[model samples]
Target: MNESIKKVAVIGTGVIGNGWIARFLSQGYEVTAFDPAAGAEERTRLAVNHAWPSLEERGLAANASKDRLFFKDDLAEAVSGADYIQENVPEREELKKSVLHTIDQHARMDALIGSSTSGIKPSILQSDMIHPERFFVAHPFNPVYLLPLVEVVGGEQTNKKALEQAGRFFSSIDMKPLTIHKEIDGHVADRLMEALWREALHLVNDGIATTEEVDKAIIYGAGLRWAQMGPFLTFHLAGGEQGMRHMLEQFGPALKLPWTKLKAPELTEELKERVISGCEEYAGDQSVSDLEAKRNEFLVKLLALVEEYWPEESQAKANI
Candidate 1:
């Protein structure tokens, strides 16, 4: 096995996979990718090209170039001798496990495999792998090149050393590596997001607020605080000198109040139309691609501001 990651193989070049490829290439890693879909190479290349300007603004690595990307029709050829591997297959457990098993068979023994699965447990995906210890979940948010947060969760059979190395590798790529202490269905961020989404659905189902209204509520309020401080810390400050303890005491009774729906509302046709129509009204005539471009532009600016504000942490993580 190679001693360090010089080349990376990206398996399943969908949105997430292509994002991973762009990120690796921006960091100057030779990236070989494979996807069986028709026009996979074209789509992946276009995705990378679309993402390149943002990456260039962020500053590319010395060896970073569009020329470093290679597309392979064969999965085995893509993985063989690769120093690092990133798997971004579908969410299905059986399919992901099957692809991972093949990737493990072909990749170098010491090369770590990071899956882009957001919800699936690493243990389930690695169950069929011949070398399960080398595999772990390295879930990143959408627009993976700009977003630096990556949740690194290891499985029961996953080697602790491999997790550490994976953290180092992700950090080296200018990402925030969150090593989850335990295995859970949704991991960390997604679980928190799921709770909020369920309540939002209930609100929309009851006609209490339109989807756009709910989004505006977040966009103009708690969302801003959440960008810099977590919910607990934000509430802690709300306690005013007494900290989280006082905040909990003051609002603890609200926990039992019928203020939220933990269970998601039914996706009835009416509610779907209301939500879709409301979103469309809010979006005007914009397509999904148009929204994505706007989002990436805003994200790039925010990423730079945050990095500048917390230079010590972000830069130190990048130096890993």
Candidate 2:
């Protein structure tokens, strides 16, 4: 709903692409999407329908409607009139570059281009574009309609004004835009997540903990506190009256301890089976769809609580 970006185009229809579509539609943007897959439109519509209830819980824009979504089989036609284009194609480098070339050829000259790539640096992704200044990475978490954080990273050629506009546009759609001026592989959030993921795999691979136990450790302990204040702030409180200073003084030595394996374990056949079977056993009778619905419900309520208790302007400024 940003004044300058009314018509939006999503250039893929996979899970992430559909998630963007649902979020854009809920924000009342007229979304035109393109995907070459068979029944891509049908699948996207179903995905939107599945996410609609959670969006309703979060509250939709006054003019929001599923009817506002449209699909075009031709990529050029889909993006021709859009003010903003979000590409969610697969992470394959050459495929992304080729798709971006087509988008660059057809999209309006001034249209802002954002890639939903989780890890690829924006610089490399934009290198082949004629209007690279308008291109950047706008990575969002899974369940894009519910998660507010979007890492907006600019490439070397990206114009500051364009990046600012992208940030403002995302903010208008109820997103927390973390503008990362420097480009790096995986940006910020994903790197932090990857670190933890590496250690988790190590634990499972080493026969130290079952996947279920790992989930419980986070769910019942750190995850709860992390939902409110992240690691730094949580540890700041852990320092008691002296804050982070005391906490660091007391625990800094642990940083050198070999308690964690930062490198991820190899995904051997046995490891894969263990992970797959463990998850299946934990899931029991619940299908993936059922779990997704439950997760959406929990996220809706958690988002509300987070908004109520989390710090606002001051906290954000302090982080900088």
Supply the TM-score for candidate 2: 0.97
Q: 1-320, model 2: which lDDT tens digit per residue? A: 23499899999989999999999999999999999999999999999999999999899999899999999979999999999999999999999999999999999998999999999998899999998999999999899988999999998899888888988898899888999868888899999999988888888999999999999989898999999999999999999999999999999999999989857889999999998898999999999999999999999999999888887634656332
What TM-score number comes out for model 1? 0.94
Q: How many angstroms is residue 171 displaced in model 2 relative to the true structure, after the best TM-score fit?
A: 0.7
Q: What is the TM-score of each candidate against the true structure?
A: 0.94, 0.97
* Runs in model 1 lying further than 4 Å from the true structure: 1-3, 310-320
Please provide, for model 1 over 26-139, each residue's C-alpha lDDT reduced to its tens digit, 9 standing for 90 to 100: 999999999999999999889999999889988899999988999988999999968889999888888998899999999888888989898999999988888998889999
State model 2's lDDT: 0.92
Lowest lDDT 10-mer window, candidate 2?
A: 311-320
Q: Rate the local accuracy (lDDT) of all candidates.
A: 0.89, 0.92
* Whole-structure CA lDDT of model 1: 0.89
- Number of backbone-clashing residue pairs for each candidate, in the order shown: 0, 0
